[model samples]
Target: MLKFTAEHEWLKLEDGVATVGITSHAAEQLGDLVFVELPEVGAELTKDGNAATVESVKAASDVYCPLDGEVAEINQAIVDDPSIVNSDPQGAGWFFKLKLKNASDANALLDEAAYKDLIA
Candidate 1:
């Protein structure tokens, strides 16, 4: 499942890796996606810090790191085709994975249920 931030990001944890993305609500709010700034693999990130950027026709927004960790991988394909974030925000549209500087960080995020409530 996924967790949400008050800043409108989404996080999904699986097999100890956290997959991050912007929520559908966020994508819709941002309008048409134009570009994506992805962190390089192995880049160290500070929790809640600026990790990347997402640009839409309307504006550019920062995507917070959400956790303190090294970036395990990034979806280069999505950077080339930002529209995927609008069509599949949680699936093929996933942004990056943080290898995790601290496993307990995931515990601080809201769960699927709470995230749903947050958006609603």
Candidate 2:
């Protein structure tokens, strides 16, 4: 299932690992992305912890971990081409993957409908 955080990050769980990214609303608000700093693979992360940083022409934003987990992977494409984040924040622009400490934490996250309501 895919879930969203109040901060505008999205999480999509598949095969036990959860893929995470910023929502398009966040990207739109940030303006053009200039840089992205991702968490190290294998690093332990806490729920709601600062996991990454994204800098745009407008401002710098922190990407928080929605749930506790270990970093399994991060998207290199966005590092190479930050504009990908502006172009596809929820698809090719995904930030990282996590081996969740507790999969049930996803239940606490907002669903797409709720997230849309928030960004609206």
Candidate 3:
């Protein structure tokens, strides 16, 4: 299942790892993404810490880590083509995957409805 942080990072859990990305709301807010800097595999990430960065025509935004974990993988495709983030924020646009240090954190993340409330 996919869960979201108030900061706009989304985590999609599968097996034991969580795939992370910026939500469509965030992409929309940023305007048109022109660059994306993704976390490296094996990097340690803290909850609420900056894990990635996205630059749009309007502004640059830091993408925060929604949970504490070690980065397991990243989408090199985004780095090669940043606009994919704005085009598909939730799917092919995923930034990275983390090997969660605490699975319980996933339970605590917001669902789609709560995310809508936050964005609204």
User: Per-candidate TM vs. native?
Assistant: 0.92, 0.96, 0.95
Q: After superposition, how far is residue 112 of candidate 1 from its true place, in Å?
A: 1.6
Q: Evaluate model 3: give its lDDT.
A: 0.90
Instruction: Estimate candidate 2's alpha-carbon lDDT, on a 0 to 1 scale.
Output: 0.92
Residue 62, model 3: Cα distance from true site in angstroms: 0.5
User: Which of the two, 1 or 3, has more TM-score?
Assistant: 3
Tens-digit lDDT string for candidate 2 (62-94):
999988999999899999999999999989999
Task: Please name the candidate that would achieve the greatest TM-score relative to the true structure.
Answer: 2
- The alpha-carbon RMSD values of the candidates against the true structure, listed in the order shown, are 1.3, 0.9, 1.0
Q: Model 1: per-residue lDDT, tens digit, 4-113? A: 77777788877677888888888888888999999999999998899989998778899898878889999997899999999988788889998887777788888767
Question: In candidate 1, what residue range of length 10 has the lowest lDDT sum?
Answer: 1-10
How well is each residue in 8-120 modelled by candidate 3, as lDDT tens digits? 88888987799998889888888888888988889999988999988987778898998899999999999999989889999999999999998887999999889989889
RMSD of 3: 1.0
Worst 10 residues of 3 by lDDT: 25-34
Order of all candidates by lDDT, from best down to worst? 2, 3, 1
Error of 2 at 72 (Å): 0.6
Which parts of model 3 are misplaced by more than 4 Å? none
The candidate, 1 or 3, that scores higher on lDDT is 3
Look at candidate 1 and give me any clashing residue pairs. none
TM-score of 2: 0.96
